[model samples]
Target: MSDIEIRPARFESPEVQKVVAEALADLSQRYGGSGDDTPVTMSDFDPPDGAFFVAVRDGTLVGSGGWRRHGSDAELKRMFTTPAARGLGVARRMLATIEESARVAGCGRMILETGYLQPEAIALYESAGYRRIADFGHYAGEDGVRSYARDL
Candidate 1:
């Protein structure tokens, strides 16, 4: 994992878009849909208000995630690790990076929305100390959707 480097990235950068497309493809396969329908914009991941990141291993982008201000809390978004990087702690490192950045930006907590179809993601969040929280976001009240939160 020492070869993996996590760093801030522009949401619109080509490398970030590549990883995001891969992630959405994975989600589309998992849910048999066009992928997540939540609205997002490049400015949502801009610094000061929020931050986006990528995990690069040997110069290849292996993972991506970001956090955006949601009131006093930071909402985690787009966390994903390529199949080839699964179990390599790439997502974990990215999660830690996002959390720290949100904290430094004055967020009091971190929150996220995921689906039950993603057991690996649920496990990761639970193990990272995230607890079930009231449903929020576009997926709120939707079947199979789950939300979690952790104090920063």
Candidate 2:
């Protein structure tokens, strides 16, 4: 595989929007309804409070993810990799970059929510040292929702 470059990105940029849409579609197909109903804003991923990242390989966007400030912790969001980019380490690279960015921003831990339908995502987080935690965010207490956290 060619080198995958992870870079900071604006959550609302056209490229990012396209990637987000793809992620939503995938989620919808997996768990039904208009995908994730969690509310998010561009400012949530802006600097000083949060950071977003995109993974590119050979000049094409392959994956994206971001982290938002949650007290002393960072909340991961919008994590996804293009279907064609799967098994190429695009998602893994993007995840590492996002985690480091949050740690550098003074976050002492990272948290995230994923659905039970996403076994791949669960595996990734678990392999990276994340462990199950109390439910959180919009899907808290909802069936099929799983939350995880890791100390930075």
Best by TM-score: 1
Residue 54 lDDT, candidate 2, scale 0-100? 88
Stretch of 10 with least lDDT, candidate 2: 1-10
Q: lDDT of candidate 2 vs native?
A: 0.93
Report lDDT (Cα) of residue 125, candidate 1: 98
List, residue by residue over 87-124, the lDDT tens digit for candidate 1.
99998999999999999999999999999999999999
lDDT of 2 by residue, 1-152 (tens): 55888899999999999999999999999989989999998799998899999888888888999999989999999999998889988878888888899999999999999999999999999999999999999999999999999998
Clashes of 1: 0
Summed backbone clashes in each candidate are: 0, 0
Which pairs of residues have clashing backbones in candidate 1? none
lDDT of each: 0.95, 0.93
